[model samples]
Target: MTPTLQAFVLVSGALFSIGLLAALSRRHAIFILIGIELMLAAANLNFIAFWHFAPQPHQPTGVMFAIFSIAISAAEAAIGLAMVIAVYRHYHTTNVDQLDQLKG
Candidate 1:
């Protein structure tokens, strides 16, 4: 059975909220990256859900957008993880609180 748009939206919002909280409350940089991924997943879900439920199902706009978003997310994850690895190598810890070198 196809899900309603309202249900999809609620789920997406909840996922985004959880992602935001995870991104903000975590001290580890990796956790923040995971949270960002979650947020991106939620957005992807919304795009697909809307496309599936759209009045004009013939249009593939949503699918195209979702695919594009996925590509961008993949690129983001790759670059972000690389940065995290570099930071870990230099700082020796993923904790955000301890890497405060910019403080004057």
Candidate 2:
């Protein structure tokens, strides 16, 4: 692979790993949601990068998937935030550690 492709893959890998780490380390519901968003963005970046470098006529497929993924991520964030608000209203906290009622 070319240096540019190598660099893009490396960056995407780093971003994915960091996002995963952030998601695993956070306890606050909002932070966890943000981490998930970051992961989705990293995946989208990887898709775009691959499409740009891949030597195939189907390169646009990756871009289309990235667009769909972005839309889905936006919807997920909206729904997740609404759920968080509802949970906070009932529990008075956004920390996941305090949500022990669902532990079955």
Candidate 3:
């Protein structure tokens, strides 16, 4: 891999790791969602970087997949945020720790 591509991969990996940590450590639903989005963005960045450095014929496919993934991520965020909002309305709190009623 080229130096630029290697750097991009490293940066994306770091971002993904940080996002994972944030998601895992947070109890607030919205913060967790933000962390998930950050992770998705890191993955998207890696996809785009790989697409840019790929062999010519395979580049377009990577880009296409990246585009599709972006669309899917957007839909996921919308649905997730909607659910969060609904949950907040029902429970009046965004903390996951407060959501114990479902256990019963």
Q: TM-score each candidate.
A: 0.91, 0.89, 0.88
Q: How many pairs of residues collide in model 2?
A: 0
**Candidate 1 C-alpha lDDT tens digits along 1-104:** 87679998999999999999999999999899999999999999999998888786478998999999999999999999999999888888889999989642
What TM-score does candidate 3 get on C-alpha atoms?
0.88
Candidate 3's C-alpha runs over 4 A off are: 57-59
Please give the lDDT score for candidate 1. 0.92
| Lowest summed lDDT window (length 10), candidate 3 | 54-63
Q: How accurate is candidate 2 locally (lDDT)?
A: 0.89
Which one wins by lDDT: 1 or 2?
1
Which digits, one per residue and each the tens of the lDDT, describe model 3 over residues 8-93? Answer: 99999999998998899999897888889889989989889988898676638777878898899899899999999998889888
Whichever of 1 and 2 has more TM-score, that candidate is 1
Sorted on lDDT, best first, the list reads 1, 2, 3
Q: Can you rank all candidates by TM-score, best first?
A: 1, 2, 3
By lDDT, the best candidate is 1
Q: Which TM-score value belongs to model 2?
A: 0.89
